[model samples]
Target: MYQYTDFDRHFVRQRAAQYRDQLERHLRGELGTDEFRALRLQNGWYIQRHAPMLRVAVPYGELSARQLRQLAHIARTYDRQPDGPFAGQGGYGHFTTRQNLQYNWIPLVDSATVMELLADVDMHGIQTSGNCIRNITSDAFAGIAPDEIVDPRPYAEILRQWSTLHPEFAHLPRKFKIAISGALEDRAAIGWHDIGLQLKRDDAGHIGFQVFVGGGMGRTPIPGIEISPFVAWDHILVFIEAVVRVYNLAGRRDNLYKARIKILVKAEGQKFVDAVNEEYRRILADDPAGHEQLIPQAELDRVKASFVDPAGVKAEPAVTLDDGDPAFARWLARNVHGHRLSGYRAVTLSLKRVGIAPGDMSADVMDTAAALAERFSHGELRVSHRQNLVLPWVREADLAELFQAARAAGFATPNAGLLTDQIACPGGDFCALANARSLPLAAEIAERYQDVDELVDLGEIDLHISGCINSCGHHHSGHIGILGVDKDGAEWYQLTLGGSDGSTLSGTTTPGKVIGPSFAADEIADAIEAVLNTYQRDRLSGERFIDAVKRLGLDPFKTAANAVRVSTAKAPA
Candidate 1:
């Protein structure tokens, strides 16, 4: 994790102070509601269905244990529903797929205090919401992945600093997202981002990026086009700026649905590419500060130096554990992952337990996670894009002890990458944008697959659920995607088959095909079960769920899903 310097600390505090003044003005009615809306959104505040929701940025998914501890304190202290279904309860925080944390019940009046608390730990909500560059995300195993071509943290950090308060592209046509990947696999889901950067090396061993433009999911699901095969590391920032500038100038603003860069790219095709390239050419040739925009080797080195191994982390001899406990073996197989270093293993602490909303963490669990990071991972933690916590530097020698402690703390479910380890959003329960609920369905499915043997037999499946069309839950990229819909004022779910996030198992980044008409909320779980049954019945030996889906296509799954729909009609309340 990058340690915050005095400048970074001062910058965050200043932003927090400014937010306090703005919030005070808004509260006193000195600032109009319409005028305060943009200001609040810029500071990561939003008025949800019930109360204010604050999204705190976790830059590149990295967090020190101390920072996490402070987050737990905020959850315990400020995230409360004074008079609602959750009145007496507090201490809830959600981890989003974009690698940020959201507090749903935070009062708008107390938001400035929350901002100040975030600043105390070098964290804030800047650009987390609004039509600006959001958090810069990357692979959860960014620096530790064994198959990494280059460490992307330095480049991600550089992009973060460049885009943070960028005067030029802050107010684009829509919210812009950027993801980078340095590993052989596309764990970051970069192709689904507004700007996707895959760090690579040329034949001569010079680091550069394979830039993809205009990939996003919403009403339209499109994979990004490869705008450039390689943008040299020094010019990557300028190249991206050119792409954003082109979109900003040409992207639609009349219709909210068509305002995304993807729409612009899809509509213009080659013309979009031509315009971006022309802009890039002008930036390098015509602009006075073009040469100054090039990244210096010294600056790159300075950022890279901050990403070194956490202090006190040293290599230890690898040990083979032949534990007789099947549960322990299952946890090892599922949660533990390979690390670049010989003795270190990255372990995912499962957050998808039944009855609990996926990604929702209470203060107790947060504290336990912080303690686990300190004891096992050198006090460094990572928030995975899959909505789970990661101990990125855990020692292989401490596997058994850590697993035991984690299980005791409800973090060890041994279901990582399995059917029960689902990715879901806070749907109708909290989000005002959602048309239906996602948490109930996610919990029902998780409860149905509690049998560990059954979950393992089903194999690793990317089951994603979204409450609405926003794609915040990344439903379009799941092997099995469930999108909530409103049918005749009743909650319904649309099932999709054969989506891929471009992982080793999923092949490439592609949107899933819808499996006919939507099912009522009550029927969705059974419908999903039907699809899984079809896969189990027809799959070749050792074939993963995604592979079977690709081989058989969507017809079989569609038929199975539709077969489970109830014949009797239920009127909407």
Candidate 2:
């Protein structure tokens, strides 16, 4: 596990103090509630339905056992320790869609204390949330993945250091999310980020990044434009700076809803990419040391050293996932992924347990997970881009028992990377930004596909839902995606198909129409069923629904949904 340096410690401590001062002044009637509310959000604080919520940034989804222990202490002391039916009656904590954690209830006064606690552990709330540089995510299996070209952890860490409270870039027009994945796997969902980078190696064995700029899902969704290619290791930061520069200068300022990098990329098109690249070339040409070729080998090496591989791990016999652990067997197949380490696999604890809101982990669960991290798996833990907690390096032998234990702790879900493993943002129920509560829509979908056998039979699918265009639910990347909006002062839902997160040139096909404002959860499922049935009849054996839908066109799905509505309406009325 990586330990914090003195420089890291000082930076967080100072940030905590600065926040403390700001909070005190706000409470003393110096700053208005509206002003303080915005400021507190920058530090990952949110006033949820029940109480104040504090989202703590777990950088790159990395957590040391000590850090986990400290998190447990915060849960136990400052908030209700929810383990039973009503323990966390009002609130506790929930890990989110991004790689972060949130304490659902904490006093404003306790905010400073929590900051001090995190700072003591060399953590900070700075840049984790709000309309600033958010948590930088990368391949959770960066080093461990067997097929990786190189470890992405070092590059991620370097970017983290450079972007944290950057002097000139702090206040952006909107939030920014940067993701990097090693050439091993698309674990970081590289296609659905503000800036997605993949570390690649050419025939010459020179390491560089394939940069994707402006891919995001919010009010509007678009695949990132490939503005540049084969960015040499030394020029990674410079290339990113160039991308940001283009966004800063050209991004929409008139409408808050239209201000994301994706929107900019969409409006600008290919000419924009070419223009930006030309501008970047000019900048580098004018001052090679000042721009593209300025990053030092020493700095890169210093970052590389911070990431030390897990020690004392040994390969052992594979656990019998099928024998006496059918529940775990399904889970292992869906959630566990191969690693670079010969004997290790990366496991995701499916927090999306049926009826409960996805990503909502209780405090007790967090503590238990922390304990489990220390005992069975490596002390390091990670959170996934898809709103799941990851035990990064579990040995093959411990798979079954780990799954059983995880089941007891509200995990053990086998629908990872499937339709039921849906992505939803905190909708109208909690978010001021949402038009409808996305969780209910997600729950409705989960209900429709509850049977594990049926879901498996359906095969691999990505179903993403967002309450609004902001796309917190990531509706843009789902093979079958749903978006909710308030039209004519009523909630209306839209469907889009053929969007994939792992493929080249991924984007939604023809957009679907606006459904009713009073659309029931069952209605969404009905529409999806119509789509699936069409695929079942049309598709060849073994073809995935996404592939089938792409082959036959989305009109079939549309016809099914429309037919269902007409039949149900005409017969009942």
Of the candidates shown, which would achieve the greatest TM-score relative to the real structure?
Answer: 1
Q: Which runs of model 1 end up more than 4 angstroms from their true locations?
A: 82-89, 287-290, 568-573
Candidate 1 has which clashing residue pairs, if any? none
Candidate 2 wrongly placed segments (more than 4 Å): 47-51, 79-91, 282-293, 314-325, 487-490, 503-522, 566-573
The 10-residue segment with the lowest total lDDT in model 2: 509-518
lDDT of 1 by residue, 88-185 (tens): 55567899999999998877888999999999999999999989899999999999999999989999999998999999988899999999999999
- Positional deviation of 515 in candidate 2, in angstroms? 8.8
Question: What lDDT is reached at residue 27 by model 1?
Answer: 88
| Global lDDT scores for all candidate models | 0.90, 0.75
308-358 in candidate 2: lDDT tens per residue?
666787565555445456776677678888876666788887778666777
TM-score, cand. 1: 0.97
Cα error of candidate 1 at position 572, Å: 12
